[model samples]
Target: MMRQKHNFVAGGIAAAALVALMGLAGCSTTAGVETTGKTSWDEQGARILEKNVVFNSSSLKGDLQIVDLRGVQAGDIMRAQATLRSRDKDTLQFQYRFDWYDAGGLEINSGAGSWKPLLLTGRETKTVQGVAPDPRAKEFKLKIREME
Candidate 1:
């Protein structure tokens, strides 16, 4: 009877260890699947410049919000437009620039971009537009910052 009890205890321990290993394996597999899904999503997003607007300055973000962003092909050039609305009750001065990129996700002219001054009145909405310098620009990133 004692030998049978020992065998039963050993079998129970083995079964518990197997269950723990399987749980760990399941968790690792789930993590791998999630990582792959995220990578795929990122790759797909990289292919298209989807309505992405980034504010480089915290003050600018607090003062204004990007209401809309869109792009169009005008002849051979890519034209981009961004609509901004002031969230504060005071006038705000900011500088913005458009950085163009090609289909493979590279900047068209790395350091040649210029910042343009923007004036926003209290509680007002404004639209800014830019045109790509060349026909090779397939994407664009619009950056806004507070003017010092």
Candidate 2:
């Protein structure tokens, strides 16, 4: 009887773990979200050249919000700032990376950018900033994803 009960409990634990793993697998998407900010100049002055927001994960789209994205020149290198807000009532762990592009829409380092950790509390608003890898970078794309 004791051996049977032990086996039953172990089986239950394994089953529960498997279910959790399956649920997470369904939500697993590395794509996360992406937003771009660029600078443009003409006769007037510097202006927001382009802005694009893309969501690759539906779950992340519902939990994370991008309030504002802006880009400016810090000396020769371009800097980017993004305002992010958490919609859920729980703290979240995420990773963010910045990709730099030149004036002709070419990526600076391609896949060289490293993912940085970001922690956002419930209903908290935070601004994250990134600096271009080189002076030729005129546009920046910010990507956010759940901690893997």
- Say which candidate scores most in lDDT: 2
User: Residue 147 in model 1: shift from native, Å?
Assistant: 0.7
Could you estimate the TM-score for every candidate?
0.65, 0.82
Report how far off residue 64 is in candidate 1 (Å).
0.8
Q: How far out, in Å, is residue 54 in model 2?
A: 0.6
> Which residues of candidate 2, in runs, are more than 4 Å off?
1-29, 42-45
- lDDT of all the models against the reference? 0.71, 0.91
15 in model 2: Cα distance from truth in Å? 2.7
Best by TM-score: 2
